[model samples]
Target chain A: MSAAASSRSGARFWTWLSVLVLAVLCLVWIYPFLWLVSASFKDPLEIFSKGLSLVPNALRWDNYVRAWATAGFSTYMLNTVLVTVGTVLLVIFHTSLTGYVLGRYNFIGRKLVIGVLVATFIIPAGFAIIPIVDLTKTLGLLNNRWGIILALAGSGHAASILLYAGFFSQLPKELEEAAVVDGAGFFTIFGRIMLPLAGPVTATVAVLTFLAAWNSFLIPLVLTFGAPGQRTLAVGMLAFVGTNETDWPGMAAAATLSLVPVIVFFFFVQRFFVEGVAGAIKA
Target chain B: MSLSHSAIRPSIRRRLWADRWIYLFLLPTVVLVASYTIWPMFASIWFSLLDWNGFERAGRFIAFGNYAEIFADRLFWNAFANTVIFVVVAVPIRVGLALLLAVVLNAGLPFSRSFRTAIFLPVVTTAAILGVVMRFVLDPASGPVNEVLLQLHLITQPINFLGRAGLSLYTAIGVWVWKWLGITLIYWMAALQTIPADLYDAARIDGAGRWQRFRYITVPLLTPFTIIITLITVVEATNVFDLMLTLTNGGPFFSSEVIDIFVYRQAFAANIPRLGYASAAALLFGVCVMAVIAAQIVVVARLRRRVAEQ
Candidate 1:
């Protein structure tokens, strides 16, 4: 009885030890973000004066005002919303249709299409940016929000398509057969039945796509290089740095502006995001 | 035989016509991918063979000229070396740390959910913005990191994390890991969930210690996932353009110039943009990446077969 009690105590000791370690680690992990938020509220001088302390001398709402109004983050935020929404809608529409067709139909060239899709995955987007830029420029899309939207959406989203394909293919054929028997056409069957049934997959795709489109930097940076008016928040942050080089407090505020919405969005849909990544890995 | 082939052709045509809406549904993706992905892939190769500044409607078809120049360019080689170092140093650290943390987190430690959210917050945050934030966070004079180090007597003077040539790349790599470590942790956690609880219970009943079960069962079971996770991390490490561009700008004497930065500088940020030369560098790097990916795929296939045999 003493031995069992000792072992139980040892387990408790280990659990407490692990909790201590994890608490420290999590603080370290989140310190940068906490620091950024605190810095945003600190006076420009106090940011340096206070050093590592997360508490500011006083709240500086003016930093946010500077970022939002004077620094033009408002415009950047609007552009980001427009571009992200456009990209997500386009990706979902295109990928779901392609996935539905590829998953359900046993058409000629289907294998070839899948093979091509898989092969393209090896080509990273960064390497192909120049050509994409050139193509976009040729099509008069450079400096246009549509250029950012199309480039983001048009990049062969093989993973999203595969996710949808995998999900749709597993669904019993009887669902579609009944729709067909009820005199449903292909568009109606897909629009009403297959798409609604793919709720989880759609959610996964939307969350992932939204994150990508929201946080995307290089493509938008390059595409909007000539047009400052078209700059998304990611690119605008860089311009903010260039213009407000010494405004550390305002820079933190700008970073917060770009980050806070996405963080809030993530908290809401992180479950789907995590599951989407796992599902993709399994596929 | 000719008569039979002719009869079957019409039936195939009819079947295709019956699924015409399917083809229509496929049109947008096909057109988009072909224009943006497929065509550009080949166009890059074609551009790499030319002498163009992107303003010219047609580049001079100087076959192999750009390739020859890239072979001789010292900066190209430097970028290549830096990329190799980045991948070699970053992948193992990222993957291994993620695995360890995932194991700990999966042990059902208190506040695991909150810990995960904290770690993953940076992953959702924009990398470019983080780069901007990190510059100040690691600022040698006024940054919190140096201040803390100094107060603890860790160093006599501040360390220039992003300004010093020797230290900038390593700093960028460290920041890159911090920003990205969350995604990898999630990957490891997901992989961990796949291990059936009964195996652990069985091992425990058989008098296996905690470390022993982890070493014997978890390690072996996680081998397949390790291959995949490592491959994903390696691939991701190569695409560090946004962060590097913001943090270092390949500065302090071009110390942190990965190939992406190299290509971007030459193509867009140069005094005279050398589109062809940039294309050549990108193609060469792309080919190397593909080779690495292919090698990994082969390794994964072989390992899977060996595991199945067991």
Candidate 2:
């Protein structure tokens, strides 16, 4: 009895210790975000004046407006929104069709198509930069929004297929069979039946694609080389920082500005984001 | 019945003609992939043969010469070497830390949900933003990181984390780990959730200690997630460029130059670009990546199969 009671106490002790450690971990993770928010409020002089000042001497809201004007962030924001929206539209259309076909239909080269698509995921985009440039130039897509849209769409095929395949495989084939029995063709069946059932996964694909297109840096940098006006928010912000010679206040403000769209985007759609990543993990 | 079937043949032809809608559905994807990925992939292979400087209208088709030059170039080798080092040092540390954190988080601690969210917020933010934000936070002089370290008496002076040759790789690794840890944690957390609670209860009833239950039960169950995360980490680490570009710009002396950065520099850095040489280097790098991925897939698949058999 005595030994059992001691062990029970030990368990309680460890549980409390675990909680303490976890609290500390959480603090560490939150520190950077807090620091970012705090630094954005500080002026240029106070930013580097003291080491690790948690409170700024005064708040500066104009920095946000100034960073926007100086970096031409409004243009970048417009460009990013265009590219992201375009990528999402293309992804939905392409994945729904291809994923539907690959998922349900029995076709020749089905396995090969799936395998090849998955294989491309491992193909590094950097190595293909020169060739991509050449192809884009030939297609007259360089520094063009269409170029960004196309590249994002092409690279997204594998992930979209993977996700859609998983979801579609779980879908009841009886729906399609019944639709066929009712004299509905492939188009009607896919449009009326499958697409509706794909709501969750479609949302997942949209969120993922939007995030990828929004956060994309290198591709836009390469494609929009020498044309600063064509740059996305990410690339524009990067150039802003690099060009300004470690201008901490301006850079912090710019960084914070760059995060606003994504943070807002994710927060609104966070339900789908969580579900998508969670489902991916389970798979 | 026979007469009706005979009349249906023409109907079948009309229906088949209308089924061209499938072709319409497939057209956009095929056209885009062909123009961007398929065409560029092949063009890259072809361009590897020509010694085309950026200014040139055309260049001599010196077959295999670029590949030869890549094999002979020391800077190419240095970049390759740095890539290997980054992958070797970063992936394991990042994955290991993630797993450890996941296990701890899974053991039923307070504020676990909020903690997970905090860790994952970084993963959602743009890496471009992270590149600049991290530079400020990790600044050697006025950076919060060093200030904390100094206060703790961990070091007498602020260390040149990104400037020192030996430490530069580690600094990049730290940033990479921060960006990636949340993803791994998510995977492991998912894996842990799949584990049956009764197993741990049984282990407790059998007088097994906490570490024993974790080792015998949690670790084995986590193998699949670990393998997948490791493979993803390897691919991600090998492809790291933006952070390296933004944080250290691949270095004070190319200390942080990975293969991707090297490829970027070769292709577009100079006034006269070396597209052909960059192509060869990229191909070589691709080969290395493919080989590693292939090995990982085979080994992990076999292990999974063996576990299933048990």
Candidate 3:
């Protein structure tokens, strides 16, 4: 858009310069992951051997073998998957259902429910860990997968419910009215009309919830303290790092294994991930 | 029964019965959520009054003794101070750098999408594991950072990044920012998009330079969003124990301890395990949290009113 040829060239130069700078910075930002991956593949003795380049001297599978065996990565991965999938499923079901009814119908005590949920959503649940532990014990749920699932999923999902509620509010009433006109009950309307159309928020809730449940540490640590079979990835990784502190290649392999699933998930769902993040933030 | 009383009671009962469908949908959620959230809230208060370890059931009730002990503890205060310093130092840098990146990325440069995704990788990963992985990446002897510096002949001796006294906490903050900056950038991006292009175009029509447009036009419109983002950051920062737990273990010499670590160590890591004192510390932690919620209500309420007025 510059009038003069020299100024146009200058503008072009600035744009290229900015792009070049940003690209370099992104490389820097990504360096840790690259190095982690490379280090994991390197021979244990050669990981620190003369390299700014990301290539390993020999692409060995030994670290992975060592990490998987030592960290009990298979069991940890299985436990994490069970808990994450279970929690995500429950959260989606509960939040979507709660959001629809609370967002739609003006029934008795609805205002009170909304008020209480909103008030409590902002508080950090870590403060209540002690009682939660006691509550789990009373319910005979300690060291159980269901206990961890319920603990993560059920409590303090007010934020997600609120997201769904806001979304439902903006949806046109004509759909619900037509459904009612066609003799649909609340359940049918919710199932056939609302939930079907809640793709964006559902995707948002799914990704965010999955990420949180997958990555959670402290609660899972408390709930499954001595239960080796029940340990999530984060806690398992911690123990792996703890025991394998000086074993750089093995630790790197463990970290890489733990990170791979989420990275892959994000890779495929990049569009939805971006939309989910921005959408939830805006809501 | 009298006719009038019988009639009124049935109407009230039927009205309630009609709304059972709503309650049916809400039943499992309310039970699960309220039992967890509401019950534990009251439970924490009660727990704070006792002197029981994690294993014991019967314990002496020392009504305000836990709070009294916390008040007298120097470590608790040190933790509190360290947290405040971390927030005071780290948050501004994070927020500023995020805004700058967001503005630059919003310029719609070639390959901006790839750049954004590359930066966002860390956000998808857990912060605690980053702490674990980073220990290797920043290790004084074997870390790439040291290796690169040595090759460049920048330093004769490797820097003790995470093991030093004063530098360890800053290292923690640096790592925290690296993981979190992407999310903040996304927030800023969402906010920036809400500012209309015509305003920028109008400023340009008036012969305003890039800096001038950013100064007079952009800054004014971004104030509300800035407040919201700052409050959210502060709220999130208070709960950052796991990073210190995994990263520094609040160490080199307990130099990186935050309030949450103090509480966690008390409840879980202590010899006798002072669950009561931990509860008390958590209650104080709850105060910091309450301030966060209060800020949210005020800003959100004001923003809503402003939107309505507009």
Compose the digit string of candidate 3's lDDT tens values, residues A1-283. 5468887898799999999999998998999999999998987668756566788878889889987876698788899899999999999999998898777777668889998898786767777788888888889999999989988887878888988888898888788778777998778988888898998888888888989998888889889886878888888888887776778888888889889999999898888878766765665
Listing every candidate in turn, what is its Cα RMSD in Å to the true structure after a full C-alpha superposition?
2.8, 3.4, 3.7
What is candidate 3's CAPRI-style docking category based on DockQ?
Answer: medium
* lDDT value, residue B176 of candidate 1: 90
lDDT tens string, model 1, A15-133?
Answer: 89988898888888888889889999999888767467788878999999999999899999999999999999999999999999888777767898899899888887766788889
Tens digit of per-residue lDDT, candidate 2, span B1-310: 1111344445545644544554566667667666666666787788889898866756679999999888898888989999999989998898888888888888777777778877887888888778778877887888888888988999999987877876787898888888878878887888889999999999999999889998999988877777877888888888778788888778868878888888888887877788887888888888888888888888888977998899
Give i-RMS (Å) per prediction.
3.2, 3.4, 3.7
Ten-residue region with minimum lDDT total, candidate 3 chain A: A274-283
lDDT of 3 by residue, B99-181 (tens): 99999899888998898998899999977889898887888988998888888899999998899989999999998888888
User: What's the true lDDT of residue B213 in model 3?
Assistant: 91
Residue A19 lDDT in model 3?
Answer: 97
lDDT of 2: 0.80
Looking at candidate 1, what is the lDDT of residue B147?
A: 91
The sequence of per-residue lDDT tens digits that candidate 1 reaches over residues B64-108 is 999998899999999999999999999998998888999999999
Which candidate number has the best DockQ? 1
Residue B308, model 1: Cα distance from true site in angstroms? 5.5
| Fnat of each prediction, in sequence | 0.67, 0.65, 0.69
TM-score for all predictions?
0.96, 0.92, 0.93
